[model samples]
Target: MKTDNSALARRLGLYFVMLWFSIGGIGHFVATGTFASIVPPYLSDPYALVYVSGAFELLGVIGLMILRTRRIAGIGLFLLTIAVTPANVQMWLHPELYPIMPQWVYLLRLFAQVGLLACIWWSTRPAPKAEGIRNGPQFP
Candidate 1:
C-alpha cells in the first residue's frame, strides 16, 4: 500500500489554520477592545479596522475549507497577516504597554507568523501535475 503523507499533513495543516483564524475572528468581536488597543495609533478608526479584519478572518476561514476558494482565501490571509504586522511590531517595540504579556511572547509570535504564512501557502497551493500528464488525454 502506498501512502501520501504530505497530502495528509497538508490537510491537517489546513484544518489547523482554519480553526486558528476562526477563533481569532470570533475573538475580535468578543474582545474588541483588546484587539483595538493593539492597533497602531496612527491608523484612523482602529475599532472599525478591528471589526473589518475580524470579518475578513471569518470569511477566509470559510473560503479556505472550500477547494474552489482555497487559493483566494490563502492569499487573503497572507495579506491579512501582513496587514497586522505593524500592530505586532508596535507591541514588540513597547513591551511596557502590554504589561500582562512578556517581551519574549511577542518575539515568539513574530516567528510564529512566518510559520503560519508558510502553512497557508503550502496547504492551499494547487496540486502538482502528475508525471507524463500534459495537455493531451491520458491512457492507463
Candidate 2:
C-alpha cells in the first residue's frame, strides 16, 4: 500500500499558509500604522500599500482553501512575496530606523520568506492523476 504522503503534506502546508496569512492580513487592519512604518521611504502612500497587501494576503488564504484556485493562488502569493521583499530589505538595511526589532529578526524574516514561498508552491501543486502508475506500469 503506497502512502499518500504528498496529500498529507499538502494539507499541513495549506493549514500553515492559511493561519500565517490570516493573522498577517488581519494585522494590516489591527495595526495599520505599525505595518506601514516598514515601507521604503521612496514609496508613496505607505498605508495604502500595507492595506492592499494585507487584503491580498487574506485573498491568498481564501484561494488556497479551494482546490480549483490553489495553483493560481500560489502564483499570486509567490509574486506577492516578491513584491514585499523591498520592505524587508528596507528594514534590514535601516536597522537604526527600526530599533524595536532585533538584528537577528531581519535575517530571520528574509529566510522565512523563502520558506513561505516554498510551502505555498508545494502545497498548492496538484497531485498527479495517475498515482497507481506513478511508480511504473501497473501489473495485473
Candidate 3:
C-alpha cells in the first residue's frame, strides 16, 4: 500500500512554517536595535513594542505546530502578518532610517511579506480529503 503522504506533507509544511515564524520572532530579540529602526516614526518605544510582537509571533508559531491548536494558530499568524504590515511599509517608505539595508533589499522585503502572508494562509488551510483526488493516467 502506498503511504498516505498528505499527512506527512502537512506535518512537514507545518514544521517549516513554525520554524520560520519562530526564528523570525527570535530575530526580533537578537536584533532589537536594528528592528526598532523600521518602526514608524509615530510609534513610541519601538524596542519594547517589538519584543511584544515577537512574543505573539512565537506563541502563534507554537500553536500552529500542535495539531489541536493549528487552526487557531494559523488564524493568529494571518492576523499577525496583517498587523505587522505597517512596519513593513515604514521600512519600504523610509529606507534612510534603515541605512543598514539597501533600497532594493527593502523593496524585496516588502514583496516577501506578500509571499509570507500567502504561505501562512495556505499552510493553515484545511487539508482536502484523500478521496477528493481522481486517480487516473492522462491521455491526450
User: Which candidate leads in lDDT?
Assistant: 1
**Candidate 2 vs 3: which has more TM-score:** 2
Winning candidate number (TM-score): 1
In model 3, state the lDDT of residue 137. 10
- List the global CA lDDT of all models: 0.82, 0.81, 0.75
lDDT of 3 by residue, 24-117 (tens): 8999899998778778878889998899889999999777756667778888988888888889888778888778888888889888888777
Score residue 10 of candidate 3 by CA lDDT: 53
* Sequence-dependent TM-score of model 3: 0.81
Candidate with the larger lDDT of 1 and 3: 1
As for lDDT, the candidate ahead, 2 or 3, is: 2
Which residue runs of candidate 2 sit more than 4 Å off their true CA positions? Answer: 1-3, 130-140
C-alpha lDDT of candidate 3 relative to the true structure: 0.75
Compared with the true structure, what per-residue lDDT tens digits does model 1 show for residues 60-135? 9998867778888889998998899999998888899998889999988899999999988877776445322232
Please give, for residues 1-140, the per-residue lDDT of candidate 2 as tens digits: 56366655666787887898899999988999998999998999999999999999999988877666777887898899899999998998888999998878997999999999898777666656633323211113
Candidate 3 off by > 4 Å: 1-10, 131-140
**What pairs collide in candidate 2?**
none
Question: Candidate 2, TM-score vs. the true structure?
Answer: 0.87
